[model samples]
Target: MRSEHDPGAFLDRDGVINVDIGYPHRPEDFRFIEGAPEAIRQLNRHGYKVIVVTNQSGVARGLFDEAAVEHFHNHMCAELARHDAFIDAIYMCPYHPDGQVERYRADHPDRKPGPGMILRAQKDYHIDLSRSFMIGDKESDMKAAQAAGVPGYLFKGGNLVNLIELILKQIGRPLER
Candidate 1:
């Protein structure tokens, strides 16, 4: 049951967190974007639950398996923890309409522009959607947030920390520290 009443920061994994070099399922290839860790840490201090919602179509395309995705998430979490930033939870959709893998060949609602993943995260984290927001590099991310009743911000590169700070300021949420 959803019990906690924390606000969440839904972030896209690819271009938002790390450099999107195609379907990156390996830890060695996961290079964090500039100031990404600090941006998350800032949110942490401001009482926001950091959540990653990504669409991993590579799994359905036969480029990788769910195990690889899990391993990558683990590595990402460990790396973020090292910087005093952490993701409260991660939600990934591996299904695509034209997937090569038969098991994941259907168009899933958890996919971006559908709001399923964000809605699930809201339930799991008991996030206050009214106070939550999403940051992404794609228009689909914005649509997902809108569908979930959360505001969305389009990040067009540069330092993520700066963008995060600006968001916090615009939202008028005072920082704890």
Candidate 2:
């Protein structure tokens, strides 16, 4: 199928894909949420665009830099690839209104609950927002999906792949496997 017609799975990074251990800027601190890679691989196998949208305010807080986040993502992606899963893209908000970093301190639209990142992805990837879905572990994540006119599912901390399966079923698109 053409990518332009493919729906997207907009995922939150911290709690959804990895354990939310606060400011995970280093690969050493990174830990995958149970079944995250398998869930992503299921999406990939079904022709869904698996994209990650995260709010990384740690950068603005001076806990870490953007390069650190990128490095972590690289490591995570490599691990996902080993499982035959791939993330189509990653969009993060490094800005925070009351941040410590002068350059990154600002209320940017890409921040969660703002919808800027998802909107940008919609435009860039030719995604159908009405058909797309967002998975997050926070209210802000759901709000962002609402703002972007996409359906949102909240994950209350557990096995990610199982939750994804339930989400798909609830959304009337149950996974075959």
lDDT winner: 1
lDDT of each: 0.93, 0.88
In the range 47-138, model 2's lDDT, one tens digit per residue, is 67788999999999999899999999999999999999999999989999999999998989999999999999888888776668999999
Q: How many residue pairs clash in each candidate?
A: 0, 0
Best by TM-score: 1
What TM-score would you give candidate 2 relative to the actual structure? 0.93
Off by over 4 Å in 2: 1-4, 172-177
On the 0 to 100 scale, the lDDT of residue 170 in model 2 is 65
Deviation (Å) of 42 in candidate 2:
0.5
Alpha-carbon TM-score of each model against the true structure: 0.96, 0.93
Residue pairs clashing in model 1 are none
Worst 10 residues of 2 by lDDT: 168-177
